[model samples]
Structure formats: structure tokens, C-alpha cells
Target: MIIKTPTSHTFVTGSSEGYTPLNAFDGALLAAGIGNTNLVKMSSIVPPGTREVPITELVLPPGALVPVAYAAMESDIPGSMICAAVAAAWPTDPAKPGLIMEYHAHGHREDAESVVRRMAEEGMRKRGWEVKTLKSMAIDHRVEKIGAAFAAVVLWDL
Candidate 1:
């Protein structure tokens, strides 16, 4: 069997409040523009030569199977904050593969984004790869009476 790799990827973030935890999560996914697709969670590897595109550029079938690296956080406590972030670090050499990092916390978007950015940088450093570009997205949700969800993802078509 031959294995195929993704040709491109995009970063997206979303947050929402809902009547239930699951509903909140679903809302977050919809806000991220991926709720209609089936998600396949993958590890942190950005294939070499993969192009980065805007999320709006993606055109997939309603039930397409999407591959992603993601982070999510949920809270039901009123006034509580939740955050999710994802970062991708590419090497200076375009032919080299890159790294992706996901982070979630009970705090603000900046904090979560910072953590994941550092994580991605460290991942590249550990691999002795020179960093060229770092891209990240983060979402923060303030919970109300019911629940709230925050999510960030590096999404790609298979």
C-alpha cells in the first residue's frame, strides 16, 4: 500500500459559548470552518514542500475526511476562560520537513499562542533544523452560565 501526504495546510482558531459542553465544542468547530468535515487527528509533522493557504481557500465536500493537528479547551464555570493554540515551524530549507505544536490552557489566547510557539521553536531546535517561518493561531473563550469552547487547528486535505 502506498501512503500519500498532504500538499498544503492552513491554521484556524475559533471560540464559542453553548448550552452544553459538546454543543460548545461543535460551535467552535463551526467557527473554525471545519464542523462539516470528519476530522482525523495526526501527529506534529508538516511535510516538506507543503504550502500554507488561507482557510477560506479550502474547498471540500461536506463530509470530507480532514487531517489535522489541533488543540481544544472547554469550561463550564461562569466567568472562566479557556484557550487553545497551534503553531507550525518550518525550516530554512524548503525541502526539509517541519514541526507543529498544540497547546491548551485555562487562560488567554496570547499565553496559549506563546506557549505553542515556543514549543514549536524548541521542537525545531532539538531536531537541529533552522527555523524559517513560524505560524500560529489562538482562540479564547469566556464561559457563561453553561459552557464555552476554544479550539485551534492545523488543517489539511489528504
Candidate 2:
């Protein structure tokens, strides 16, 4: 499912049998009516290829963190630092504050490592996270057919 500002687009390619008439709009209306959605619920589903993954599969436990990692954009393009932007709730002493969460995207752009470094520094020094760690190594996939692929990190913190 690809969700734009207001409309959500879903794509389905069934086996030779073809797909049934599934209406994403109707489903969205139902979801809205049921009061099951919030602002971030807009892009609630996984991207095209990651559908089979389980929701709890990538969760990082408290006191644990993922490292910096990279994926090949296809060998021609240079690699970039990537951040797994996440909304997190810091554990409060009494939970009195409830869930204090914030939205942040981390990582360095392919050509701008300095910018990434600065952002990382800011996040670590002032972003309220209890921990920060480089999660994964970089991989360059600069194949011609893939075009000039942007530097990106695929895995995410949910």
C-alpha cells in the first residue's frame, strides 16, 4: 500500500487467476469509521516487498539499539549513511508522563556524510535518546539498470 496525503493506493498482483475487487477506499472509510486510525496510521502498511514480515519482527528492546548499516543502491552510485527514523516512547519513572514519543529520521545522505554526522551528534546530545549506536555496514549496489539509486537504509526500528 502506498499512501499519499489523503488517498491510499494498494496494488495486488494475484497469480494467473487475477485479484478480486478489493476497494482500498472503502476499507479506509471502514477503518476511519471504526476509529482505528491516527495521523501516523496514514502510511500504516509495509512497502511493496516487505509485506510478509511480521510486525513484532524488527522491534528493538529497551537498552538495545541497532547499528549503522547500508544497502547497495544497485555499484556505480556512492553509498550514503541512512537513518531508521522512528517514533519512540522513553520509559518514564512512573509512566506518569505516559508515552513520551517523538519522530526522528537518522542517517547520512549518500553525498553528505558531514550532514549526517552533525545530525547524529545533535540527536545524541540533545534528542533525549538513552542510547545511540552504529547499526550496520554499508553495501553499494550501483548497477546501471537500477539507475542512480539513492543511499538508503532498508531495515527500520518499529
lDDT, candidates in the order shown = 0.82, 0.24
**C-alpha TM-scores of all predictions:** 0.92, 0.24
Q: Report the C-alpha lDDT of model 2 over 1-158, residue by residue, as the tens digit.
A: 32232111221110010021123222322322211222123222222222222222434343332221221121122232222122212222322111111121223333233333344445444645343232111212222221221222222333
C-alpha positional error of residue 130 in candidate 2 after TM-score superposition, expressed in Å: 4.9
Instruction: Give the CA lDDT, 0 to 100, for residue 131 in model 1.
Output: 95
Q: What is the alpha-carbon lDDT of model 2 when measured against the actual structure?
A: 0.24
The 10-residue segment of model 2 with minimum total lDDT is 12-21
Query: What total of clashing residue pairs does each candidate reach?
Result: 0, 21
Candidate 2 RMSD to the real structure = 15.0
Clashing pairs in 1: none
Off by over 4 Å in 2: 1-118, 128-132, 145-158
Expressed as tens digits, the lDDT of each residue in 44-144 for candidate 1 is 89898888888788885798777888898878889988889899999999888888899998998899889999999999999999899998888888888
